[model samples]
Target: MQTRTYNHVDYLWDDTKAASLENDEVALFLYRSNILGSDLRITNYGGGNTSCKTIEKDPLSNKEVEVMWVKGSGGDIGTLTRQGIAGLYTERLRNLKNVYRGLEHEDEMVGLFNHCLFDLDSKAPSIDTPLHGLLPFKHIDHLHPDALIAIAATKNSKKITREIWGDTMGWVPWQRPGFDLGLQLEKCLKENPGIRGIVLESHGLFTWGDSSYECYLNSLEVIEIASEYIEGHVKKNGKVFGGQKLESLPSGKRIEQAAKLAPILRGLCSSENNMIGHFTDEERVLEFINSNDLEKLAPLGTSCPDHFLRTKIKPLVLSLDKEESLDNFNATVQILQPQFEDYRNDYKEYYEGCKHSNSPAVRDPNPVVIIYPGVGMFTFAKNKQTARVASEFYINAINVMRGAEAISTYVALPRQEAFDIEYWLLEEAKLQRMPKEKPLSRKIAIITGAAGGIGKAIAEKLVAEGANVVMTDVNQEALKETTKSMGKDEAIQTICDVTNTTSIEKMFDLSCLNFGGVDVVIHSAGLAISKPLEETTMTDWQLLQDVLVKGQFLLAQFGSDIMKKQGLGGNMVNIASKNGLVAGPNNVGYGTAKAAQLHMTRLLAAELGADKIRVNTVNPDGVIVGSKIWEGEWAEGRAKAYGVSVDELPSHYAKRNLLNEIILPEDVANAVFSLVAILDKSTGNTINVDGGMANAFVR
Candidate 1:
C-alpha cells in the first residue's frame, strides 16, 4: 500500500457539514460515518469509537464535571442511532490505568464502575469506555480507519507511523481490544505526556478536542491526510473489473418468484411477522443474483465486524443447477455446523478461562453465514433496516474480497476470535438496553402517484412520521426523480399502472416483501374524464373506472389481505373527487367512477371490518397545484365550462368553500395522516378536505 496526501480543509468547511450536524443526532452520526466510512479513515463497522462529552455540575461537590457520551458497543456507525451513545462516568475511566493488572476480568470491573457512577443508564458501557472516560477533551473520536489499517497491517507499520506522525503521536501494538487495549492506551498517553492522538498498530486511529465538532473535525483531518498520502503513493494499477452484466430475467416471472420467495426467506430469518415487505424487491434480488463470481467470491464478510450481526458472515449462493444448488446449500450449512459448534465451545473456554463472577455468557454461536449456489443473499436481521444494512455490507464485502483477491489473497478473521467478538456479553447487553418501543418505526405505507401533488405530500408526511413509504407512479422517471431527494433507506420508488391487475399485485407483493406487511395505503392515482355525457364513450368510461374505481378496489383488496394476515388493522385512504359527492355538468364518467369508488370504500370497510382493515376517502374540491386534474388540458376545459379563465378557477372554487381559501395537497395529506394515526373508531367515512366546499349547495 502506498500513501496519498490531500487537504483536509476542503471537506471540513463544506456547507453541508453544519446542516448534517444540526439534524437528528442519528442523522448526524450516519452522515459523519458516510464521510469517514467512504474515505476508510476513522472507523469501520465495530472497530472504532466516538464520544461527545457534556459538562454537568456535581451537586455534592458543587463543581463542574464531565460525562462522556460515547458510542455503545454492538451498534454500527454506518447506521448508529441516538440511543447507541452510552453515557459513562469520565472520572472513573481516567483512573483505571493506575491500577495494577488492569487486564484481568475487566468485565466484572465495569459493573463496579457503573455502580459507582451517577445518571448512567443500566446499559453496559462500551469496552472503550475507559479510553473515552480518560480523554480530557469534551469530545473524542476513534476508529480503525482502513487507510491506517492497511499501513498497520503491513510489516513495517511502526516505521511507517514514525515517518508520518513522528514523536508527537503514540503507537500501541495490537492487543485483544477491550480492557487490555484501554489500559495500553492510558500507558501510552502517560508516557507521551501531551500527545494529540494515538495510532494502534493493526487497528485504527484516535483524536480528541474540546468540543464534539472539534474532535470530529480533527479525526476527519488526520484521516484525510492519511488517505491522501496512501492514494498518492499506492500503485493501484491492478485491473479495475467492471460490474457484472446482469442476465435479463423475465420481469413478470422474476417479480412473481421474488414475491413467492419473500415469506419463506422472512420466516427462515426469524424476522418479526409484520416485516416481510422489506425483503421483497425483485429488482434488488435480480441485481444480487446476476452479480458475477458468486461461487468464487460470495463468502467474504463485512468491511466491519458489527455488520456480521445483520448480514451474517456469508451469503447463501445458489447455483444454476437446481439439484446441485440445493445440495451445495445443504453441504455449506453442514460444513458450517461444526464451525459454529467449535466457535461456541471456544467462546465458553474464553469465558471460563477468565472466570469473572460478574461476567455473563452471551447468546449462542448460531451460524451467521450461509451459502446457496444459485440464489442471492439473504440477510437475517431482527428488523427491516438492519437487514438492508446487512445486505449492503455483504455487497460491499464481496467487492472488497474481489479486490483483495486481485491484489493478493482473501484472509478472514479466525473463527474463534470472530465468535468471541460476536457473542461478547457486554455487547449483547448494550443491544438489550435500547428502547423497546419505537412508536411507528416499522410501519409500512404505500402512496400511489407519489411523484407529485397530493401523493408526494402524503408520502413525505408519512415518512416524517416514521412510516416506511413505498411510492409509485405510472411516470417512472418522475417517480425515481421524486424519491431521489428523499432519504433512500426509508423510501422506495416503483413504476406502477394501478389499473392493471398484474401491476397492482406486483406492487403489493413488493411492498410486503420489503417491509414485512402493509399498514397504510394512500391512493392518489386517478384520471378525470371531463367530456360531456354524450361524448363519453364506453372506452373512456372503462379507462376512468380502471384507474379510479378498479385501482382502488385492487389496492384495498391486496392491502386488506396482508394486513389481515399480520393481524394489525390497516388504514386505507382513497383520493376521491368532491365532484363525486356532488353532481357536475360535464364530468360524467369521472364523477360516476369516483362515486362508485366512494361507495366501494364503504363496502370494503364493511367487508374488511372483520379483518381489522379500515377504508376511508378524502374528497377534495377543485384544482390543487400539480394534480393532473388541475394541470394540462383538463384545467382549461373545466375553466371554460365554469365560464372563467384558468387563473380564476381556483378563486371561483375557493369562494364556494366556507374558508374561502384554495386547498393544498398538504392540507389533504394532513387530514389523511390524522385519520390514519388517530381515527381508528371511524371507518367507512368520507372526510371532505375542500375548505368547506360541501356547504356550496349549488346542486
Candidate 2:
C-alpha cells in the first residue's frame, strides 16, 4: 500500500492524552474511539463498533482472564463512556464456535452473548461483537467511513480494493453481519499475514493493530487513502449524478418552498401516525435532488444496512413540472397527494413480494425521506433526532453514490438482502425491547411568549409528555434560559414578535425546519395594563390589542395553516383571563383584549373543525407567582385597585375567589395540557384555572 499524507481526515490523536492513559487499555480504547468518532468522515453516528482486549481479574474464579471490551448495542462511539462498553469473556466467546450451527443459526448467538458477560452490570453486547473477539489483534476499529464505503459499494468493489491498496489490505464479500462474517474476517487476516485492514464489500472497513495507537493510525490511513483515490477519480470524471439537471432555487426561495411543502408532505405521510419533520437544503442534498440521476439512483436504494434502515428503502422524490411553482402550495399539494399514494402502494408491493413466513409484519408504509427537485430534502420520523439522523445518513448515501459513480457504476444491495436486514427477527426483537412510546412522542408544539412563566411551564409539561417544542418569545434572554432547561434535542428557541406577521411566518418556517411541522400552538404572549377608563391611553390599548388579540389571531392563522396542511388533528390553547367574562374595576384595555382572544378561540374552533383543528381557552386568575405580568406595573395597579399592597395581592385575590386558593402558572399549564391531551373530544370550550371565580364563570 502507498503511504499517503492525510488530506481528508484530521489526525486528532494527542500524545499527552494518550500517555496519561497508557497504563489503562480500556481508557485508551475509549480515547481512540472518541477521537475517531469526532469526525463524521470516519464513522456515522452509532454506525460502527470498536473493541479492545485486556487481561482482568475474574470476579468468580479470582484468576486473570482475557476480557474483550466492545461498544454496546445502540451506543454511539462519539460520546461513549466506560459504562457504555460491554465487557465479555474472550475465552467464552471463542468457545461459542464449538456450538455454532453455521450462518443459518447466527441470530441465536446474540441471545447466548449474555452467558459470556464478564461483568453482570455491563451493557448488552452488539451483533458485531464476534467480529472484534475473533480477531487476533489486541485493538480493533470497525468504521463505515463514507470514502471507504464508496469503494465497498461499487459493482467492482474487490477489483477497486486491490487497485487502491494492492495486497496490504484484505477484502470480504457482502454478507449480513454475524458470526459468519466474523469467521470470514479471521480467515482473511490469516491468509493475508501482513495486511493492516479488510474492506467489507457493501458494508465498511475493519482495521486492527497490537496497540490502541497503532489501530487508530491504521483506520485513519485506510480512510485517508480511499478518500484520496476517490477524489482523484471524481476530479477526473467531471459530471456527477449525470450533472445537475435542475437549477437550485435561491437560498431564501428554497426555505420558503421547503416550509410550504414540509407540512403538506408531513400531513400526507402521517396517515398511520404523527411524524416529526426535518428540512435540509445543505449543498450536497440540493446537488443530488437537482440531478438527472436522482430518480434513477435514489430508487436503487442504499447499500449499507445502517443507511437504508434509517432512510427507508428509498426516498419519495417530489418532481415538479416546468410550469409548476412551489409558491402555489395548494397546487403542489395536488401533485404530492397522488404521488404519496403511489409510493405507499409500491412499498406494500415490495413488502408482499419479499416477506418470508416468519418475517416481521409490514412497518409504516410512508417514506421516511422525501426529496424535492428545486427545494431540498424532508425527512420524517417519530422524533426530531431520528428525522435529523435519517437526513444525515441519506447524505452519506449521496456521497457514497457520488464516489462510486465517479470511479465505476454504483451498485445497491439486492432487494432480498435489504429486506432481510430491514425485517430481520433479531432487529424485530430489538424493536420490541424498546421502551413504550410516550403519549406525545410524535407531537411538535410551538409556544409563543414561552419566556414567561405560563408559557415556560407549558413547554416543560409538553416536553415531559415526549413533545418537541419550538419555544418562541420576544424576550431573547429569557427564551434562551428557558429553552436551555429542556433537553437540547427536544426544545429549540427562536425570537418571534407575534405582533409582526413576517416574524410569525419566519417562526413557523423555523418550526418546520427544526421539528417538521406544528401540531400544537400555544398562544400565551400578552401584556396587562390596569387603569380606570379615563386613565387608559391609546398606546396601552393599541399595544394590548396588537400583542394579545392580533398576536393570537396571526399565530393561529399561520399555525393552523401548517396543521391543516399536515392533515393531522391539532390543538390550540389560548391563555385568556377570567376578566374576559367578568366586569372588573380599573381594567378596560386588558379585559377587552382577553375577551377578543377568548372569542377568537371559539371562532377558530368552529371554523377549523372541518380540518380537525381544536381551539380552546384556558382562563386563569390571580396567577401572581412566577408570572412576568406580575413583575411589571400590572401588579401594583391591581394591588392599588383592590386597596392592598403589591405584596398582599396574592392572598387578597385568593381570598376574593370562593375557593380561597392562589392560582399558579403550573395550574394554567395543567389546564392546557388536560384540554389538549385529555379532552380529545372537547373544543370551542373554556377551562377555568381560577380558584372558583363564580362571577367570571363561562355562560
Candidate 3:
C-alpha cells in the first residue's frame, strides 16, 4: 500500500520547499494542498479541502491551543492563499458534537462553525469543515481523486477496496456530508484502529497523518494504489464503455461541427440567463461520447456530488448519427429543438417530484453539459471559465465511469439524495451571496480593426461591461499588443482581412470556438482620404470601398447567420463618419464609402428586423486625438485644404464645429455602446459623436 513511485499521479512534494517552511505548519499545509490540487487526476477546481491542526496562542487567554486551518468555502486548493483558509478552534469544533441534535439539524452546525473560529477575520468555513475538524490527525486531505472515486463509485467498491488495501483503508457507506458523516468517519476510524485512511463510498477518499509530509505521502500512496488497481482491471477488461458504437469524426470535421452547433446550444441553454460556452474534443471525451453505453449511462448521471453539482444531474445527449453532417444547420436545429424542450420538461418533472415544501424554486431547467456522438462535448455557463471547468468535471466523471465499468458496474447517486444536495439551503445562500453580474455579462462581441483607436476603445468598453470579445485587425503586432492586457476570458485577438472571405470565416470560427457565439458586432475598420476629385484616382476610390464598404458587408452577412441560428436577437453597429451626410470640400472617395456604410446599416436593420437583430451607425467627426486615420496623409491633406499646419488641424477642426469641441476615440465608443446596450428600441438610426455638426444633421 505504501507505493513510493506513482504511475497515475505525480509525487510533487519538494523536500527543499518543505524545509523552507521550517516550523510554519500552515505554510506546509497550503503547499501540500497546492501540489495535490495541481493534478486534476487528484482533485478538481473547488472540489477538495486540505487542513492541518496547528498550535496557536489564544488571543484572549494567551495560552496555546490547537487551531484547524482548512480551505474556506468557494476556494480552490490549487490557488488557495492564506486569506482563503479558515482557522477554527479544534477543541470547540469537537465540543459541538455533544449538542448535535441529529441529521435533521445538520445545517445549523454550519452556522455554529463561526463561533468556533480561532480568528474572527478568517474566511467562511465550508460545510465540510466538520469532516476535517472532528478528525484527531494533525493533517487531513479530503479529495475527490478520479482514481479513488473510480473505486468508490462502483457497486462492489467495498470488495474492491478490501482487495486493494486490505485493513489499511476502511470503508464508510454513502451519506450526505454533514456532522453525521463526520461522526460516521470517527466511528469507522475507532473500529478499524489499524486503518490509515477511509474511502467514503460513492463520495471520495479521506487520508491523514500526524505530520504534513506523512499526510501528503499517505494521500498519494492511497490514490496510486487505487489507480494502479483500476488500470490493471481496465487493461484486463480490454475495450471500455461496452466498446465504442460511433466513430469519431476527423479533427477538422469535428471542429467544423462544434462551431456550427455551439451557437445553437448556447442560445437554447441561455433560456434562463445568457450563457458563455466552451467546446472540448479531448480524446477521453470523444471515447465516452462514441461509446455504446453513453446514452444508457449518461442518463444515470455522474456518481460524485461534486461532479453532478457542476455538470448537472445529467447531460443532454444528442442523437446525431455519425454519417450525418451539420451542413444543414436549419435541419439540425429542427431535429434538436424538440429534444431541448423535452429536456426542460423532464428537469421540471424531476424538480416537482423531488421538491420539499420549503425547497428553493427550480434552477435553470436546461442542461449544463451536452454531448454529440461524432463531434464532442459542449458546456455552457454564465462565463467562459465556469463553462470550461464544467467541461473538465464532466471529463472527470467520464474517467470515473470508465474505471468503474472496468472493475464493476458504475453506479450514480440516488435521485432523491442528489436533489437534496442540489437544493440545499447552504448552497442557495452561497449563490445569493455572489456579486451581481455586469451589464453585458454573458454577451460576446466581435470588433473589426480592433488594433486601431476607435475599435480598440469599443473593445475595451464592451469587455469592461463583461462581454467576451474577438478582436480582429490586419496589423498582427498591434492586435496582439492591444489585447495584451485583456484576459483570455475577456478577449482574444487574431489577424483578419475584412476583404478576404477565408480570413473572415476563420475569425468567426475562432470566436465560436472561444466564446460560444456572437451577440454583438461592431464594424469600425475604416480609413480616410481628403483630396480634390481631380487629384483622386479610381484606385483610391476602389481601395476605400474595398476596406470600408465591402468589409462591413461581409461581417454583417456572416455574423447575421450565427445570430439567426441562435434565435437570439443581436446588435450590429457600423462606425461611419460625419462626412457621409455632410457634403465637404475635397472629400469624395472617403465620403462615398461612409455613405455606403450608413445605407448598409439601414438595410441590415430593415432586413433583420423579424429576427430581432438591431443595426445602427455611429458617426464621429474630427477625432484628432487617438485616431489612427489622423496619423496619416488625410490629416496633412485636410490641414493644407484649410490653410493650417498639420499640428494645428486639431484646434482648427474643433473651432470649426458649432460647439468648438474635439472628439476622441472613446467618444465614438460611447455612442456605439449606447446603441448596442442602451438604445434597444432604436435601430436604423445614426448617433453623431461629432461636436454639433450642423451640416451632418439627419434632416
Candidate 4:
C-alpha cells in the first residue's frame, strides 16, 4: 500500500516572469507540465499528456480562433519546451466528431491531426488530441499515476472513486482510444456537470479546470484521494503478500551478485552488432523478485499503457534462490542458458499471435526486463541510458501490480491491445528519428590505470565515441575525481588493484553490470622499475612481474570469456614498452615484464582468433608527457641515467627517434582508438607510439 498527500507545490515556476507582457497561457501550460513531469510519481520519462485551450489570432486568417496546444508525441514532459507542444485549431479537431465518428484507421486519425494543425510546421500533437479537444474546460491534465491506476484497476473501483470524489469525478469504461473514447469524456461531463475529474478503468485519470494551475491542482487532489484509499484499504507490511519472508541480501553481496549476473544475461541476449546491458539492482527490487506471487503477477501486462513501448507487456522470468548463494546463482545461470532461448521463442510466438498481415515489422523478440531470484531483476536496452529508462518504467509497473494485488486483481488491457500500441507507426517513428549510433556506441570498454596519463585519455576518447566505459585505478580518490569530471551518466569508476586476481575479476564484473558486456579492454596499468642486474632487489623484480605479467593474463582471460560468450569479436589493447625490444642500460626488470606482455598479446591473438577477438599492444618509449608518472623522483632518476637535466630528458629521448617530435598521451590514445575502434582487419601487431624508435621497431 502507498500513502502520499498531493501537495499543490508550484516547482520551478516564476510568476513574475510569466506576467511580464508575454503569452501567459502557453507559459503557464509549460510551467505546469514541467512541474508534473519533474515528479516521477505522477508521470515518467515520456508518459502522459497535457493540453490547454486558448484563443489566439490566426496570422493568415486575421481572426482569433480557439486553439488546443497539447504535448506532442515522443518528447519528455519534464523538459517540454515551446517547440514540443503542438498547436491545433480546437474547432477543426472537434468538428471531426462529425466526419470521423466511425473512422477506424488510427493512421488516418494521425494524418487528420496534422491536417487540422493551426501551424503546419508545429510538432505533431499527441494521439490523445481527440479526448482533450472534446473536453469543455480551458485546460486538461492526463497523468498515468501509479496510485490512481492501482485504485482504478481494482474490483468495484469505480464505486470507490465515486465515494471519494462524489459527483465531482466520473468513470469511463475501457475502450480502444480514438474518437469514441473522446466522446465518452464529453458525455461524462455533460451528464455530470459538477465533475472535477474522470477515472478511466484500465487506463488513467483525466482532470480539467479553467486555469492551468487549477487543472494541475485538480489532478493532484484526485490522485491524493486514490492514494489515501490504497493506504487505508490495502495491506502494507509483514507476511501479508508474497507468502514467504523475503530472503534479503546484504548490500555488499547484492552488488557482487548483480556484477556476476549482468554479463551472463547480456551475453545471452547480445549479438555481433548490438548489446543490451543488465543494469538494475536495488534492495526493494530484490524483495519483489523473492515474492512467491511475483511470477504470477509481474507478467500480466503493464497497468500504465504507455510503458508497453519501453518495458513490453511482461518480463522473462528465471528461477533460483536468494542473492547470497553464489553457487546457486552460477548453477542457475547454466540452466537458464538454454532457457533464455525459450523465452525469445515464446516472445516470437506472442508476436505471431497478435500480428496482422499489414502490421508493422515485428521487433526483436528478446524481453527487455529479465527477472530471476538470485539476480533480483534487470532491465536491458541498447545503451545504459535507455536501459535506465526501461528500468524506471519497469519498477513503476512492479509497484502497480503490487498495489493491485493488495486491493484486488490488477486488470490491464489485453495482450492484443498492448501489441497494437507497442507496434504503433508513430511510436516506431520516434525510434527511427533517434540519431544513428557511433561505431562503438553499444560497446563496453574497461580501462585500467585510468586515474591519469594514456589510460585517462583513452577512456575519454571511448566515452566521446559513445562507448560505455568503466575506468579503474588503485587510487580511489583520483579515480572518483577523474570520473566525476566526466559525469556519471556514461561512465563508472572502480578501484582495482591490478596485481590482485580478486580485484581484477571484480573490475570486469562491474563493467559488465554497467554496460551489459565488455567489448574492449585497455590494459595500461604498470609500474616502471629501471635498475641494473646488480642493483635490482627481489622486491623490485617481483613488483614489476606482479603488475605487468600477471595483470595481462587476468585481463585477457576475463575479457575474452565475455566476448566468447557473446559470440562477438572484441578488442584488447595492452600497453608495453620499447625497452622490451631494445634494452637500454639498467632497464632489466621493466623490460623483462614488458617482453612477457608482448608475447602474451601474441599468444592471446592466436588463441582467441577463432572467436574473432583481436589482441594488440602499443610499445611506447618515455612518452610520459601528460601523466604524473614522470613528475617526481622517478623523473630525476631517469634524467640521471640519461646524463641530462630533468627538463632535457624529454628532448634526449625524442631526438633519438626517427621522428623528433615528443610523443604525448593524446598520441597514444589516437593509436589505441584506431586499433580498437577504427581498424577491423588486423591483430597481433605492435603499433609504436614512440615517434619511431628505429632500434625498437618490430617487423
The C-alpha RMSD in Å for every predicted model, in order, reads: 9.1, 2.0, 2.1, 3.9
Model 2: per-residue Cα lDDT over 233-314, one tens digit each:
8789788899988888888888877777778888887889888888899999988988988889999999988898899889
lDDT-best of 2 and 4 = 2
TM-score of each candidate structure, all chains considered together: 0.61, 0.97, 0.96, 0.88
Candidate that beats the other on TM-score, 2 or 3, i.e. the better one: 2
Best by lDDT: 3
Task: Evaluate model 4: give its TM-score.
Answer: 0.88
Q: State the weakest 10-residue window (summed lDDT) of model 4.
A: 1-10
* Cα lDDT of model 1 by residue, 1-699, tens digit: 112334532343344565657644434544554455543234444546666666667767888887666666565665565666676557766666555356557666566556435455523566667766655666667776555554544445677677767886778876646666777787888898777788775455777776445556767666666655555543464222224444544555444544544433333333223342344323434444455644454544433354444554445543333122222334534544454456446545645654445455544333333333233445545445665655554544443344334333444444445555565666567667777744456577899889888898888888877778899999988888888767766888898998888888778777755765578999999767677888889999899888888888888877776565455678899999787788877888888898898899989889988877788988887756667667776787688778899988878888878888888888888888877887878899988888776542323
lDDT of each: 0.63, 0.90, 0.91, 0.79
Candidate 3 lDDT by residue in tens digits, 1-699? 234778888888888899999589999999999999999999998898999998999999999999999999999999988999999999999999999999999999999999999988899999999999888999999999998888999999899899999889999999998889999999998999979999999899999998899999999988988888888988998889999887888999889888878888888898888889999999999999998998779999888889989988899998767556667888887888898999999999999999999999999999899998888899999999889899999999999999999899999999998999999988999999999998888889999989978999999999998889999999999998998899887899999999899999988888888888999999988888889999999989988999999999999999999998887899999999998898878899999999999999999999999999999999998888888999879998989888999999989888988888888898888898888888899889999998988889998
Residue 6 alpha-carbon offset, candidate 3, angstroms: 2.6
Compose the digit string of candidate 4's lDDT tens values, residues 348-466. Answer: 78789988776777787777888866456777888887788888888777666667667667776688888877876666776798789886788889999988888888888888888
**Candidate 3 clash pair list:** none
